[model samples]
Target chain A: MRIKAIQWALSAAVLAMSASAFSAPPTPAMLSNACAGCHGTHGESAGPSMPALAGQSKISIVESMKGFKSGERPSTVMGRLSKGYSDAEFEAMGEFFSRQKPFTTSQTLDRAKVAKGAELHEKNCARCHVENGKEIKDNSPVMAGQWVKYLEIQMADYHSGKRKMFDRKAERMKPLSQSDLDAIAHFYASVK
Target chain B: MTIDRRSFLKMTAGAGAAGVLYGCASTGPSGSTADVMPKTGRRVVVVGGGYGGTIAAKYIRMMDKNIEVVLVERNDHFVSCPFSNLYIGGLMKDLSPLTIRYDKLAANHGIKLLQAEVTGVDAASRTVVTSKGTLKYDHLVLSPGIDFRTEEVKGYDIATTPEVIPHAWKAGPQTVLLRKQLEAMPDGGNVVLSIPLAPFRCPPGPYERTSMIAMFLKQHKPKSKIIVLDANPDIVSKKGLFLKGWKKHYEGIVDYRPAKKVTEVDARSKTVLVEGLEDVRGAVVNLIPPQRAGQIAVAAGLVGADKNWCPVNPTTFESTIHKGIHVIGDACVAGAMPKSGYSANSEAKACATNIVNMMNGREIVDFSGINTCYSFLSAKEAVEVTGVYKVDKEKNTIIAVPGTVGVSPDLSELEAIYAESWLKNILIEMST
Candidate 1:
């Protein structure tokens, strides 16, 4: 009877493991579906102010989410939303967004501002952003083809100390005026 | 009682003839017959094509293409209430932007669109009787939205006198009517807007409506005033921001009176009677009556002890009363979740996930959702209230996570821009 009891326990343990194995872990697509409501489908936003998340590097997305969750980043809504997810979920979402096609803005840009912003980008941002902010190397998110208005808001946040910026980028941005930032936004948006 | 082959054959023939005759007789004037829908291997029948129902249908198909999803809605097109106030405020020139056709849901997502009213649900048989025909389902999702409790207010019948005192709550023809009344009123005319009690659909909707009407009056008729009779003790949502906006933009134009319950309405005289205060007259009366779960839910006996809203398992949104039936949107009693379009959309996604899991014989996971409701203070500025929620399995209820429930720091044009984006994105998510 003792042997039978032990055998029964062993089978129950095996059954539990098998049951868990049959239930697959949630995929990145599943984890990121909730973000589509405001961020647009596949992380491509339709509005100018809401930033598109498509094709952003995994590290950039994770870092931004961590900042939002920790209150290190000031946001209108993301600060509250970020608290709902875990680091693991954020990683999954980052990986999902990284695999999507990059966003291309349909908004019209000021031609003169774009030209001026190109000079500003080459002077300050191109070192890190690379390829006129089109390259996603060095863990930087793709700035080219991003929404112009959203880029302007981020610059404003950094200027106001509402958002923390890395020391090097902050130093580079400190000398630029608001119009220069606007020009930079136009320059990035003008990219295909 | 055993039957031989010859006797069984006779019985089968007789039954087949009767079945054919019955099928012929049951065909109605609408060219609908009983049990006309062809059965797929696994089918989910979603009634009502509002925010919740459409999302549920589309996501279910997106999650599992093999599972057939049929979306039944009375209206051929969807008119979003989220931005209807803008249409009424004249920020939008027409209702075209607010309206969405169900064609994409059918063509893009492979959802079978049925434009029919659901008359009854036979839970025991797992069949839904609609105006068109009876549809069988492996699972059912009901998101009929809200129906007014018109009986709560004396001398108010929405059916008979919708134009006289337009509630405009449901947004469509009523929205146009309210806009027209505002346009026709004299420059200095007083517009009376009544608010219903709590647990109503869109807690901040009336306040936003008040703001929009105030905007219209302020621009078109400077002397015009809006008398807001709120049934609640105070503003139920984004209280400080709404108050600040009213004070800053519409100091004298918006006369907000809280704790004043609307008891009756004299539609002919265009007067509203308060429980304790004197009767108030208006050039245009926007009386928003109390609401409950939509008629189909009430008829299906899905409502809980409150006899108002349906109760469901927070994780799956499946009806607590019926085994295979799920209820969502404004019809369900979602803990700590306001009855907003965003909430409904969130609930639908969670519900769709579980329904797909259940069909695949997978374990159902817990529920987590986010709700963000944006209210425009003006054409250019808006405020938002958001909450991140998770289910407490022990309590069998959903609770907002700590530090995740908050309103916007202040109203701004930036949020207004986000608000438009939110609507645009959600519509795309739900429809496409």
Candidate 2:
């Protein structure tokens, strides 16, 4: 409700902004305009190859952006993007994306494949990616409802030594097969 | 791996769209269940899926959930005309990042992405005729960009033959061709680049191109020299900075000639005759010819008082020449905005807003947008120009807000880094 009031006030402020030298400040969504073409608007990406940023925990969003900015984390596009915003802006964006309801596209679920993935996830990956889609750690995002292709590729990339942030993640992921990856992706996708 | 241009565009463009609307491409709504579009809904047919059209299609869906949006484009993949100069300059290697398909728009926004040419338009009945079939629309938007005035040059028509001379302006095969010729030329050879008159897309682009190529030659072919022949009397944008750049780093390797026009070209002889000067001979010739609104725009009767371009109401971007038809991007003659990617993007937003408002019977709100264009002086040093615009009701055109106009006072490496991020951000905004 307060966000609505702020929006109304911003719009009213803009009506008189033209009379002054500088225009009204950009709205959070407007400030997020740079990310729309690739990341999807309001952080809900339609491309399965890319992860949706919407509805994630604010801590994960802020930490990931900060990590990319400081080169503690690596990314092709995100690293460059992280440098463009300030620490305050990153926190604000974290809040903005978190506030947005996730708009994930539904895929036809394979009941057998999902069951297989759930078993594997519970035995090997449950310590990090918890049940019910919530993370115990602040840096890890909720894996439920993520684009399936993004998850599959990330898994394969991690195992094949393409993307690396943790030696421990590699140890756990190294033994997984192609079907195992697919099943795991579907398992989380099928989660509510 | 060896997919032809057409099929490659189709597959990559639909990489994400395959699961949802991929079947829509092979047939109309009658043949496939995936192509279902309700007959009762309001439809918007956008011709050309470049910056202006894509943004308009996405925004219409965002602002009003009920409206049906269909984007008609010839290419399955979009190749950004911006940042292509970097490809030519050897600063960038891969063109894969520049190519984007329509998968995300279709999957996320419920926009129908059709890969086909717009053959004709029945303006009176609001019908867009395409290669596949006809689509009826409540509103039609044309962002078909620009076409080179090939005939204006005595020896060039982009047909029959012109391989020896390449424009490299439209960001396709020509961009690749110019780069190859530059790499092949001997270190001692002379390279000539011709600049068309004002109002061409990206007023500072020719200068930026010259700088990139000079930077490339400075690394690989150190002995070669670049002579820039300008039809306009001076640098069109960032005049002082470009002048300083030419004098500072490129002093011995770069030559600048102003107020000189290319009158004739003999590709076989590798010569271009410049006004008031001797025949300019070169191993490579980058000729940016006179430009006009793209063919589709002219075909749809969107051109108005300005014979070469489309005249749109500055606020709404609706064509003054044709009601119910709007034009944006480089095709429209915006009062003060340069024909640039940033300008097209801003125009698309305003155009989309007014479009939704008009459909809802809401009063039109006044608006114009902003543009910030950067030019690299070298591989590391860069400068920028930015402006804000508002509608002038009396003149019926958008003009730059006078006091807000800004240009970088000096060159900086930081500005160059910002320039790279700017391209990255823009690509993200237009496509994913």
Tell me each candidate's TM-score.
0.89, 0.67
Write one digit per residue (lDDT tens) for candidate 1, span B201-288. 9999999999999999999988899999999999998999999999989899999999989988889999999983579999989999
Query: Second chain only: TM-score per model?
Result: 0.93, 0.89
Give me the runs in candidate 1 sitting further than 4 Å from their true place.
Answer: A1-31, A109-116, A177-179, A190-192, B1-31
The DockQ leader among the candidates is 1
Quote model 1's TM-score: 0.89
Clashing pairs in 2: A37-B428, A37-B429, A37-B431, A38-B428, A38-B432, B13-B101
Model 2 scores a C-alpha lDDT of 0.73
DockQ, candidate 2, comes to: 0.04
Scoring only chain A, what TM-score does candidate 1 earn? 0.85
Query: How would you encode candidate 2's per-residue C-alpha lDDT over B297-369 as one tens digit per residue?
Result: 7776777766689987766677776656789999998988889887887788777776776666443555546
True contacts kept of each: 0.43, 0.03
- What stretches of model 2 exceed 4 Å from their correct place? A1-192, B1-40, B160-162
- Isolated chain A: TM-score per model? 0.85, 0.77
Q: What does candidate 1 score in Cα RMSD to the true structure?
A: 6.8
